[model samples]
Target: MKKSSKDSVVTAAILLFNSKGYSGTSIRDIADAAKVNTATIAYYFGNKEGLLEYCFTYFFEQYINKMEASFATIEKGAAICLKRVVADLLHYQWENIQLASFVYREMSIDSQMVREIMATYSLKEKYYLQKIFERGFEWNEFRPHSIPYLIIQLKGLLMMPFMNTHYMREVLYVFPNEKFFEQKYLKDLYQWIDKTLCSDIQIKKEAIIK
Candidate 1:
C-alpha cells in the first residue's frame, strides 16, 4: 500500500482505539504511535473527535464493503442467504477481531456514534439484511416469529466469541482466532443454522445457488 498521512492516522487510530478507547486515546497518542507529529493528526483529522469519527467510518466502511461482496456472491433464498451471510460474517470477525472489538467497544461506551455509523451505512447495506429477512418472511422461509430478533441473534452468535475474549482466553480456552474460520467450523455452523431454522420449513436452500 502507498504510504500517506491519512493511512498513517487511520492505522494509528485503529491500534490506539483497540488498546485505548475513544476517550482514552488522544491525538498525541495516535501521532506518537504513528511516528508523526501531533500537528499531523490535527492537520489530517481536524482534532480528536474528528479522528474518532474517521476511525468509526473507516472501520465500518471496510466492513460493509467486504460484506457487500460476500453477500453479493451468496445471497438468494432465506436459508442459504442467512447461512452464507453468517458464514462470511463469522470469517470476517474471526479475521479482523480488532475491527469487531473496536466497534463493540465504541458502541458500549457511546451508542450515538454507533447509531450514526449504522445510519450512514443503513441506507446502503446496513439495513439490507432487513430486506432479506422481509423477503424470507414473505416466502415463509424464517421461523414463524420475530425475524428481526432472529437475525440479531444470529449476529450475536458471531459477536459473543470476539467481544468476550478475556473470558474465552481464561475460562473456555476456546478463542475465535484465525484457525476457527476454517471450513470445518463454518460448515458446521452453517449446517446448524440451516437445520435450526429450515428443517421443518418447505423453503429450499436456493439462496447460495442463486
Candidate 2:
C-alpha cells in the first residue's frame, strides 16, 4: 500500500530528529524530506513539538497495547508472561530502532512532553509491570524484591542497549540492530529473570536456617 502523506512526514521527522536533535532539526528540513509543505505539517501536527509528542505517543500506545495483549493471553507464571511482554516490547523497539533510540534520548530532557508521558503512559507501564510482579510473588514464582526497583531494572535493560546504540556499536562492538544481537539480548534478559526473579529465596532462607 502507498504510505500516507502524514506517515511520510513522521518518517522524515524521525530520521531528522534522530540525526539532529529535536532542537537542531527544523520544520523546513522535515518538510523537504517528506515532500510536504510546512502548512501540511502544521495542519496535521500543529508544530514540531506536536510532531515530537505524536512520535512519543505513537511509540507508547503501541508499547502498552502490546503489553496488555501479552498479559491477557498468557496464563502461565510470571516468568513466562514477563518473557512474552519483554519479547514483544523488544520486537517493537527493534522494528523502530531509530524512533526508539531517538525517543529515549529525547526523554532525558525535562520538558512538558516528558512530564506528560511520565504522568500517563509511564504510569500505565508501571501498573502493568506491577501486576506482573504481584502475580509472581503471589504464585511464589519470583523471589522477594521491591517492585519499583524491579521496574527500574527492567526499564534500564530495555532502554540502555537501544538508547546507547552508538556505544553498543563503537565502544562495545555489539551491533544492536542485528538479528544475532536480538537473540543474545533476549537470552540475557531471560537469564536475569531466572536468576533474579525466579530464584527461590524462601528455600534459600530455610536452608540457611538449617
Model 2, CA-based lDDT? 0.89
TM-score of 1: 0.79
lDDT for every model?
Answer: 0.70, 0.89
lDDT of 1 by residue, 1-210 (tens): 777977877877777887777678887888888889988888887898888787668767876776676566434565566666777777777777766777766766647777776678745654657666666667777665565676577667767777866676789777667595355567777765666566345344445445
The TM-score of predicted model 2 comes to 0.92
Span of ten consecutive residues with least summed lDDT in model 2: 199-208
| Candidate 2 Cα outliers beyond 4 Å, as residue runs | 201-210
Sum up the clashes in candidate 1: 2
> Which portions of model 1 miss their true places by more than 4 Å?
1-3, 70-75, 122-126, 181-185, 201-210
Highest-TM-score candidate:
2
lDDT of 1 at 43: 86
